[model samples]
Target: MSGIVVFGAGGRAGRAVTREARRRGHQVTAVVRDPRRHAGIEADGVRLLGGDITDPRAVALASEGQHAAVHAVSPFTGPERGFAGLDPEFFVKAAEALLRGLTETRTHRLLAVGLFANLKTPDGTPVLDDPALLPPPIRPFALAHQAGLDRLREADTPVDWLVLTPPARLERDAPRTGRYRVGGDTVPDPATARLSYADLAVAVLDETETPRHHRTRVSVYT
Candidate 1:
């Protein structure tokens, strides 16, 4: 069984992923802002601990001694910043903290939950290339995801890292058949619509154990 550190256990995707990972027979450490608030989750086999994604020390503490980490922290939460408001400082700093923690612990694999904006059209154009196309609060985060992908690409660490892109749809209540498709870099068929959060978790765990896609980006859809 793989040992995992989930960076944002209280968030939607993070919660889904952590539970799914547990269901798949992996050991999980559920890192949250307040462990006491998540007593139910904590009791259900996750080792819950308080953590702040913006703080490297907290991130490192949470990231330590795990086989790999899933960066499922909701990257943005604002109305004005649009997609542009995804704080680069917060994400980049958190990444640095994670890297440090993993390096110190000598952990090897890292699978990141990248935004769909990191994907490119068949013509090599970005989906979020225009300001008008972006949601007022989500644009910044999409850009931050793009920037995070670039930094991850350039990181020459000893660990193996993979950046996986999830569909733009954030429908938490969607059904999941545990079946989906995965691709690299190029965008998937946008015409098909949203993917369930459960399917996304399946894809994440599949990549976590397989190691077939390393240090590159994989886009997932259903």
Candidate 2:
């Protein structure tokens, strides 16, 4: 079985990816800030590792011997938590660390979960730019995410990375239909754009195994 290391395994996206990876018989290293608090994620083929996504040493430790790594780390969990202590360059640090660590470990593939705010509208305007689509208060988080994506795009590394951007309406409790549509950088129609966390995981693992896209970002929705 292929080994996959997942950062942010304690979060919704990370948990979904971990479940999908195990369901497909892939060995998973679930990296969280503290393994003790995330005891529930432990399973037959999953190994829980405590590590920081922005630390190259920790990332390298978790990435060693893994075939591919998933970058699902997020700084802000919810609006209720506020953005007071949020680092604007959180993603940039993560990209730098992941690239350096993965290169050192020879882990070639990196699959990342992206924010929908970065996707452009039909008129070529980013969703994050439009206050109607994205609230002004949340823009900082979106900008941080964009910075991380930019870092990945500008990097000259051997690691092949792909960022899967999900729609705004990502339902965590929705079932896995094993169905999703891939689109380019533009955002899909709001009326028709939706995706389940489970299905997103399916797409992540599919790319992990087959790797149809490389060194770029794509929108995934149902």
Candidate 3:
């Protein structure tokens, strides 16, 4: 079994992935920006490495010798930016930094947490483009993720990557049913865009354990 490195391990999604991977008995490394604040992760018997995802050197150090890596880092959400709100470009910056680190280290395996807005409707139009489907405030964040996703697709690298897009509403602390339906490009159920973070983490870990949907985009829903 290959050891897995999970970026943003202190975040909700990152913690879920770390927990799931550890449950599977695979060697796991949880990378966070602050070690003192996230000491609880170390108590889970997983190695806790302090590193910033936006720093190439830090990311490379965390990626060293790891078989796979998961990018679950999200931007800081708040109204501190006044009406303009948070910097939407944070996703692209973080994604590029991690990509650079992975490419430099020849860590070919990567799975990134993606936005549901990137997924298409049944009619073949990206939900991100539909203002009615996506709220006004979050449009910027969605666009930022889309930009990052576009770059990933255009970049010609040895990395075997997949962006795992979750549903619109990702519930935290929900039950881990360990069952989900996989879809390509569009959501499987147009009516329901909801999934538990635990189940989504299961899907992520499953894909990590076995190579599936490589160099592609996939979505999971309960």
Candidate 4:
């Protein structure tokens, strides 16, 4: 079983990933901003790390000895999900922390949980280039997410990093058929549908173990 650390473990996707990791018998650590707030994360088998991802020392200490780590942090903040207060500094700091953790922990592989808006549009153009797709309000969020992807790529590190793009329609309540497909660069499914949070969790774990694509961006959908 792989030893894994999931950043942002208290969030929707993070919780699902942790749960599925345990079902597979992997030693899973759920790193969170506050352990007590996520009391349910505590159980017989899982290890919990309490701290903010903004802290380099904390991330390094928590990520140590893990085989692979998944970053589930959202670039979105506030009700508008706007980047009104968005600071690249936050993510830059996070990059430092994650790099340290990967180095100190000897974790050789990491997967970035990316967003769908970062995917290209129908005309085969990068979505970030199309204003209509992004609109006024959520545009900043899209840009920030895109920037994060860029940083992940440029950051110098020994660990292999893979970016996973999720469809925009991804629904938390979607039914789990345990069925899905993966496409690269752009969105895979023409249907433009959502995968169950459960199913997304499955995809993340599957990629971690099998890793068919390395140093590449992949999209998952049902």
Winning model by TM-score: 2
Please give the RMSD to the true structure for each candidate, in Å. 2.4, 0.9, 2.1, 2.1
Residue clash pairs of candidate 3: none
How well does model 1 score by local distance difference test? 0.75
**lDDT by residue for model 4 over 163-184, one digit each (tens)?**
7777777787776677778887
Q: Write the per-residue lDDT of candidate 1 for residues 71-162, one digit (tens) a residue.
A: 88765543443444345666676667667777777778887787776677667767687444355456567766676777777877876888
77, model 2: CA deviation in Å?
Answer: 0.8
Each candidate's TM vs. the true structure? Answer: 0.89, 0.98, 0.92, 0.90
Tell me which residue pairs clash in candidate 4: none
State, as a TM-score between 0 and 1, how close model 4 is to the true structure: 0.90
- By TM-score, the candidates rank as 2, 3, 4, 1
**CA lDDT scores, all candidates in order:** 0.75, 0.94, 0.84, 0.77
Residue-level lDDT of model 3, residues 8-49, one tens digit each, is: 899989999998998998788899888899999988789999
**Residue 58 lDDT in model 2?**
97
Give the Cα error of residue 14 in candidate 4, in Å: 0.2
Give the runs in model 3 whose Cα sits over 4 Å from its true position.
Answer: 77-85
Report residue 151 deviation for candidate 2 (angstroms): 0.3
lDDT for residue 172 in candidate 1, whole number 0-100 = 86
- Best by lDDT, which number? 2
